[model samples]
Target: MKTFCKFLLFITLITLYQCKEEKKTTIIKKKKLDTETSSVPEKKIVKAWDSLNRHNTEAFLTEFGKQNPETKVLIKTDFGNIKLRLYKDTPIHRANFIFLTKIKYFNTTVFYRVAKNFVIQGGNSDEMYTQKERNKYGNYLLKPEFRKNRRHKYGALAAAREWKRNPNKLSSPFEFYMVQKKSGAYHLDNEHTVFGEVISGFRTLEKISKVRVGVDEWPVDDVKMTIEILD
Candidate 1:
């Protein structure tokens, strides 16, 4: 009877040990399962929206402005670098420039229209890449954000607009210009939206304005430029 009891006790210990080993194995399997599950990439819900039109432009820019809080940009040119500061009050235009810079849109563009002593217009290029980029982004117009105080002072940054048939004076989102006139082109105060001003690099602006241009004011040698946001 004592021998039988000892055998039974041994059997009981063996069963308990097997159960403990099974529990450890189960735990290992669960951990491996969890790791495999975590390794699998989850489906991301991304917005594939197109064409920032009048309906969505304002809302898009408003959100974009909040995301990109950068107020300064550096325009890199063959001539020299021009530092600029975007105004917070002109949120829409400021956001637009910041967005364009972040996307590397200005890298493929050039100082297309340089009116000597007046303004140096840029962000348009002869390369098809420029048009392709514009198409990719959107063919949109910016509503006039004409602040009475934002005059076209020398080194002022403003948007290009069509004055021929545009009664509302909506600004062209793709192109922009900087006033080079020392006296200030105040006549364009209300017509064009002066969204920013050159903080430094007036010399660069001067050099760019002096570049020889054709009858249409397009530079003889394309004034290629790349604009980057400054922290």
Candidate 2:
């Protein structure tokens, strides 16, 4: 009986030791799993579009055009509202202008450059908000969509560009001008991309073009413009 009792105590001790080891091993495994889970990197969130660079600009604008298919817009200014219709031929420029309009970028800008009786340039301003607005959007230029039929007719709307060193004549996406001359500024036909034309705003264009301007062509009084999409 004494031998049996001793054997039973030994067995009990062994069993206890095994149970303790198993508990420690389980705790270690749980800790290891928790550490691994914490160390895993988080997934990145994707956006529909980002800053408009040369590489992604065309595709983004093309897609944006499909999504936001609007063409007619009204430009309200101190002079009067100019009703304009964007041409379908200049798809890229049309989409780009629509995108800018929808974003309310032109609301903070003005007719910064007005060449009396020749052209009234807008989409810029001297105010700090103008620069901030530009900074908020991506910096990019539109590839010129100079259609063979498009010309700088009276009240014609066209994109502005940096003439110096721009061989391709890539248009500045923000700045644009209207040919106020009745005879038409035919000289600028091929040089600038005529993306749209004044539907019925020649009188307003005439008034804006004749605003009193400084030596730099900027109006003495601010010519603020608020744009709204009609369709």
Candidate 3:
């Protein structure tokens, strides 16, 4: 009977020890699971597109002017370089252009549309990177900033928009064009926002304007361009 009792006690002790080991193993597994979970990287969140109507125009314009006062930019193209000066009267347009240039948004974009004796449109391309950049920036449109004093004279820098779809004549945030005609495009005065004018590189503008374009008005040979803020 004592042997029987001793054997029973031994069994009880072994059972206790096994239970303790199982508990320890469970704790180790839980700790390992927690460590693995902590090692996983979190995903980055990007801001959604804020429409133009939602923006506080007064505050936006004020902050933009205060931050980006310089009104000059140099457009470097595969053909040649074109220097431009933004108009102070069109503060919003000027600030927006400068902001895009500072961010290198024009890099790898092609002078997609070239109309001889009319205009040379740019600031967009068919490349995936161009679309990616645009997506990264978010979707938004700029309100028209037309001034009587600002006309589409030769080398005039103006924003392009969808006239058919946009009844208000809202300017596109990404696309811009340069007037290449010797005479000003007077018809575009109220239609588009003339933000800046070319101070130099008329020859360069001429060269880009003469590039061959297909049916869609896209340049046959890609005329890529990069922009730099001069002032």
- lDDT pick, better of 2 and 3: 2
Give each model's whole-structure lDDT: 0.90, 0.88, 0.83
Tens-digit lDDT track of model 3 for 27-49: 99999999987866777763322
Each candidate: RMSD: 8.1, 4.4, 8.3
Each candidate's number of clashing pairs is: 0, 0, 0
* TM-score: the better of candidates 1 and 2: 2
**Residue pairs with clashing backbones, model 2:** none
Q: Evaluated with lDDT, which candidate comes out highest?
A: 1
Q: Please provide TM-scores, in order, for all candidate models, with all chains considered together.
A: 0.78, 0.80, 0.74
lDDT digits (tens) for residues 129-187 of candidate 1:
88987877567889999998899999899999999999999999989999999999999
- In Å, residue 207's CA in model 2 sits off its true spot by 1.1
Rank order by lDDT, top first?
1, 2, 3
Worst 10 residues of 2 by lDDT: 46-55
In candidate 3, list every pair of residues with a backbone clash: none
State in Å the error of residue 137, model 1. 3.1
Query: What is the Å distance of residue 138 in model 1 from its true position?
Result: 3.1
Error of 3 at 85 (Å): 0.4
Candidate maximizing TM-score: 2
